[model samples]
Target: MSGFIMLKHIKHLNLQYFIKNLPQLSHIMFMEPSYSLQIYHKYSYEYKNGNSNCDDRTHKNLQNYKFKCNSNQKNKEEFNYPSISEETLLALAEYFESFEEHCDSNYDVTYSDGVLTINLPQKQGIYVINKQAPNRQIWLSSPISGPKRYDLVNGIKWVYASDGVSMHELLNKEIPTFISSKKKDIDFTILPFGGKS
Candidate 1:
């Protein structure tokens, strides 16, 4: 009866909500040791099964995941990996530029050199996309999920090193949703690739 219960592995947001509502819960009989224990067990199960009531929009805000790196680097001489060609880089820049023009004015997009930045309104955060010439990768810093690195495969697609999600697919899924509104339906497909329409 003197020991304590440690809630391990609870997500940060869930923990915050629990702590915030503890006083209210206590007022409603949760202060009783047995009731508290029952509540804790119920929530613990929910957390483990990914059924927590936390809002989906804010779930990815926690930057706790580790980024994956290339494992094929075996020697210092081999460190200099092949990067995307100038032509491909130009195409990507053009693509981003087109996206900027089509997206709602609420967002501020900029592309310079090999970097493309999408600055969202306050509270939404920013996304940074750039080419890692030395690593032969395309790197993304997502406001929602933190940093991810992508490598080109088959001379056509840039794929995330950890999950194999293509850059084209990720942007197509994320960007439109971020800027969606009643009047605007942004199409990420407008991004030009190697002169293709």
Candidate 2:
């Protein structure tokens, strides 16, 4: 099989660990997950034999479904997928900060279907791509890992530097309690989003 076909197969297997069955791909292209952030839900219903009130309750119950994942990491060295919690967001932000050539001001953020899509500054060795839903989150592998679906409702959101924001600046500017003791370094080329242009 071709590399594209193999890659799709890998993503298919990865998705099975979260979704009930393999996800239906409308078309087969090598587009990174970041470019696609649409989430579709097909609601289902069932008829119940009872009073109107009982029927209402039964219908509600049938509609109340959730997503859960079975742990299936392809690599033993990789860390478990982080939750989308505030801390996880922070961790991601920190990861971005560690890049040698920090390409700031080249990021974007959008929200759809309760999932937050964050585009980070691209750098060498960091291939990031992501598509997230409230229940299932998918990302293209970087120096980290390739694209895979994960559960994050209860998972902590580890914001890393990769999220493309200066944690020190945010903490100092947004949250006063995190004041740093050392003198802040200034970058003259960094543009007004207060990031390196």
Question: Quick one: best lDDT, which candidate?
Answer: 1
- Which 10-residue window of candidate 2 scores lowest in summed lDDT? 68-77
**Winner by TM-score:** 1
lDDT of 2 by residue, 78-105 (tens): 3343333333334434443433143445
Computed on alpha carbons, the lDDT of every model, listed in order, comes to 0.50, 0.30
TM-score of model number 2 = 0.24
Model 1 bad stretches (over 4 Å): 1-93, 99-106, 121-123, 182-197
Taking the tens digit of each residue's C-alpha lDDT, what string does model 1 give over 1-197? 01222223222335436644443333222112233444455555565577766543323322111000111122212433343444445555555555554455666767777887777644377888887876666688987778987655434555554454666677667766565354265444344332123
**Which portions of model 2 show Cα errors greater than 4 Å?**
1-87, 99-123, 129-131, 143-145, 153-197
